[model samples]
Target: MSEQIEDRNVARAGRLDTATLSDAMDRLGIVGQCRAIKPRDAGFRMAGRAFTILYGPAASPPGTVGDFIDDVPPGHVIVLDNGGRTDATVWGDIMTEIAHRRGIAGTVIDGINRDVHLCLSLGYPVFSRDNWMRTGKDRVQVEATNVPVNIGDVRVAPSDILRGDADGLVSIPRGHEERILAAAEEIEAAENAIRKAVAGGMRLDEARAQYRYHQLQTRAEGAKP
Candidate 1:
């Protein structure tokens, strides 16, 4: 029975599309929207499940935020939900190194992060609202790991499909990964056909009309004369 549960979890995580993940982010209206770090050198491509970390102001002691970094697993992104505070830094240089060494996919914070140069130099992916040199202990702490966390009005659970690029970051609910991916693939195909039509000397208006780019109007009109 335990094995079956484990298998089910694995199957669920694997439902996401490796290629269409980014595209889905774009189609779903969640892409390239993260605030870029100064001297922007932080970005990476990773495929795996998500491991979330929750945070709060009174969550931990002073000078000990690194302790939370120890709990992350390999092939998982350390998503930190710091209640959207842009004042303190929840991530830093040492923490970045440790996370990378542990095979962590990346780090996403709903707050500020420090050590921008170090993280970028290490080729570790980090997504946050802003960057700063302030330490986390002064204003933030890791309250829990692999738990639900609120990020920008969204509650993210562990093992969700997280795909982000220069555009922005997005969390795809685990159960909806397969369906969303299938939808994104179909959307891509439809757009590609439209592009080909335009490239074949068809006027922009003609292409748009041929593809019914305004499908809404057709639906509404079908109910009329």
Candidate 2:
């Protein structure tokens, strides 16, 4: 993606919530919602490009887990894919402290996290399947970075836009960001119009009809919203 396009999409994405994005993906026939992945705190929210990390079972000799935080760019959310393992944690207090100090946007793990108190106290967002106390040091090892990985059942690629909130996380593919954002904006606008109409005493059915509410999330031909 061009720098200009990325900036534009990122800015637009910041204004959107996961609910709208998920509806947009549905309309576009894209599966972007990360199932079962939720924010640790209901009030936590984050939006940024993705810095992906893939983790796998540790080697027989127990290879190093990883020390990739130093390389993660500020304002990018660290996305860890541990194959949805919840027994051990790949993130901890020290990493949270450094990530917060470095201006990192947030962290999303398909597996789990430890030392969540640091995240809460620092006001840093950490979204994942769950939180556990066991460390993953010798249980798992970093397999790759900036590569495609699965979070829930969604595919997340490097640089993909991630918008996470109390609801959950949604990974917006870089190539489809523009279309997805446009669709979400349209959906939001329609919903707002419906709300306004209803508030003005119009019948709910009439308001929905005026906004084509039923068709708002219906998949269109050519997958164009």
Candidate 3:
């Protein structure tokens, strides 16, 4: 059952954009949108299962910052929760190069990242609260891995589907992925039909009316579509 679900999630991750997924989440009353977290480059896009990491203040000796990259599986997103600290960076050029070479999907941070030029040049997606030159090496340490973490204001668990594009990133809970994907697919189809109608000379209002645009993301009782 778990395998089947994972497969479904992979399929959804490949096809859905963050906007549609956000709508689906809203319809389902799920708060998966990561506020204030955005791509280092607006052109960068990524989709993958999350490999979560939680961060905390460094101990007296100052623990390591990014050794976890070596163990992350390919196609898994590295979600770093740095407590929304923008003063220090949890990622940089070397990590970008390594993550790109390893086929890792991308990195999303609640803090900031330095050396973003490398990511832009290499096309390795890195999303964060902001970018800075300050190093997080001795300021923060890995608290845990494959653990539940907060990004923006959303709670993300290990293996949750993460989708990011020009707009921003959103985390879809694994358990609700199937339902969310279904609603997103429906919403996309409706929007497409509206677009088609508009292209075929129908008024924008008429097209939206025909497609019931306002209700596409309306929250339903019990989270039913």
For each candidate, the alpha-carbon lDDT, in order, equals 0.63, 0.93, 0.91
Write model 2 residue lDDT over 1-88, tens digit each, in one string.
6888787887788898899999999999999999999999998999999999999999988877779999999989999999999999
TM-score of each: 0.74, 0.96, 0.95
Output the TM-score of candidate 2: 0.96
- For residues 67-135, what per-residue lDDT tens digits would candidate 1 score against the true structure? 766667676777788777877888888888998888787888888888888777888888787887877
Instruction: Show model 3 residue runs off by greater than 4 Å.
Output: 2-8
For model 1, what is the alpha-carbon lDDT of residue 221?
A: 25
Top-TM-score candidate index = 2
RMSD of each: 6.1, 1.5, 1.7
| Candidate 1 global CA lDDT score | 0.63
* Comparison by TM-score, 1 against 2, better one: 2
Q: What is the lDDT of residue 223 in candidate 2?
A: 79
Error of 2 at 122 (Å): 1.1
Instruction: Quote model 3's TM-score.
Output: 0.95
Clashes of each: 6, 0, 0
Instruction: Report the lDDT of model 2 for residue 34.
Output: 99
